[model samples]
Target: MLGNDLPPPTEVINMYKLNQIGLMRIYEPNHEALKALRGSGINVLVGVRNDELQQLASTESAAEDWVAAYIRPYWPQVNFRYIAVGNEVIPGEVARYVLPAMQNLHNAWSSGVLNSIEQIKVSTAVAMSVLGESYPPSAATFSQDTAAYMVPIARYLNSIGAPLLVNVYPYFTYVENPSDVSLPYALFASESAVVIDDGLSYYNLFDAMVDAVYASLEKAGAPQVRVVVSETGWPSGGNGNVTTPSTAQKYNSNLIRHVLSSHGTPRRLGKSVET
Candidate 1:
């Protein structure tokens, strides 16, 4: 989705079907992609553009219109799932608008023609920067600047029983400190437990990073809220000496196997993760 070189949406859907990848997340409503998703039976996580937050927050009508144009037409056939209100907007200029936009969108989704349709939960996607502390997962808390909005957003998601979408990138963390963060640990190739926090063992960076966000949610007074790792992947190439196709394949291969299992994480045992 990051480049124009990708296959047509129809072919992409076919590829997903052939590979049995049941879930797909598109950053925005690509009409053709949505059309292509019709009857594909692939549950989709769709996003609301960050720029559209202000307008959607301004009026419930805007959210309603948005649903009419984007969602109403192909819902059942498209298998619409989560609707991300904003992606990584917290701590940014429009951070203040996210919660309101989510509220409005949720209201619109719950009170219109779309209302009768099963819930398509509204939540925001956040990056690792939102965490104030991350080393010891149990000690993680939302950074001061982001907490003002993140806490409320977390609570709102809890109120609506929606899971928080997190973008977890061990690559960024590893690249920043390769010496401290071993490549095997970052890529989920660690053969032994690397860290122990609050008596919970962590074998890989992905779980640690995700557990950090979970801990932050606990402190945010939304401990009951679940987490959805909306995005997580390693670079296939580009970084000098660091990026390689084999490494990328290894990381993703292990990642998929891990998440697809019912083992979950040490923090949330037996609960399968939705990647």
Candidate 2:
């Protein structure tokens, strides 16, 4: 999903149908994939490349031009749900462009330049590194250095109806501290003992991680904003035993069931997530 190049449109369509995948996220707008997905009934989330953020953020005209060129051409035919301003670029060198680009894009969409704007939202994606302290879930808060940028982004997201997109990987956590983090806990094993934090029980790492973001939002005075898991997966190839097929299988399968069951994190009980 990160690359601009993709498989043939026909093959992609066939694969999506075969796998019953109703939604897809592409890192950048790949015309071939968009063409293939057109009228396929599959919802898509297209991205703005990090390098192009400066241009888009500089002026509303640039953002409008981008939408006109990349999105309007396939309007109605392609069900684009969100315009991902940037992917996992938060807290990096280009972090400054995240919010501005989102604002410009939102302005463009709301200007009625496009046929449909209500159906599309604007946001950026971030990784767990944005949090200074993620343990205990309740202790989570944006890092001091990044809070200046993150708080505004959160506020903007809350003002609009967009969710804070984040990419969480418990696999990386387990790999980094295998001695302390249990594999079963990371894999969502039903038999694993619940890790109690703030008197609430966390049955798996995914929920705990998600609750951390919620805690951060609450601290930032933007608790109303929702959090969406834009990306998550166990690696099939890596440096250690953490990349085994069986581990990937358990994590992905249980994750699907956990998310689909309408189970929200402890911080937001009964309120389903939009990941």
Backbone clashes counted, model 1: 0
The runs of at least 3 residues in candidate 1 whose Cα sits more than 4 Å from the true structure, single-residue gaps closed, are none
lDDT values for all models: 0.92, 0.86
* lDDT per residue as tens, model 1, 1-275: 78768798999999999999999999999899999999999999999999999999999999889998999898889888899988999899999999999998888878745667646888889999999889889999999999999999999999999999999999999999888999999999899999989899999999999899989999999989999999989898999667899989998999999999998988999998899
- Candidate RMSDs in Å, in order, are 1.1, 1.9
Q: Per-residue lDDT tens digits of candidate 2, residues 72-91?
A: 88878988888889887878
CA deviation > 4 Å runs, candidate 2: 1-6, 113-115, 190-193
Best by TM-score: 1
- The per-prediction tally of clashing pairs is 0, 0
Question: Which residue pairs clash within candidate 2?
Answer: none
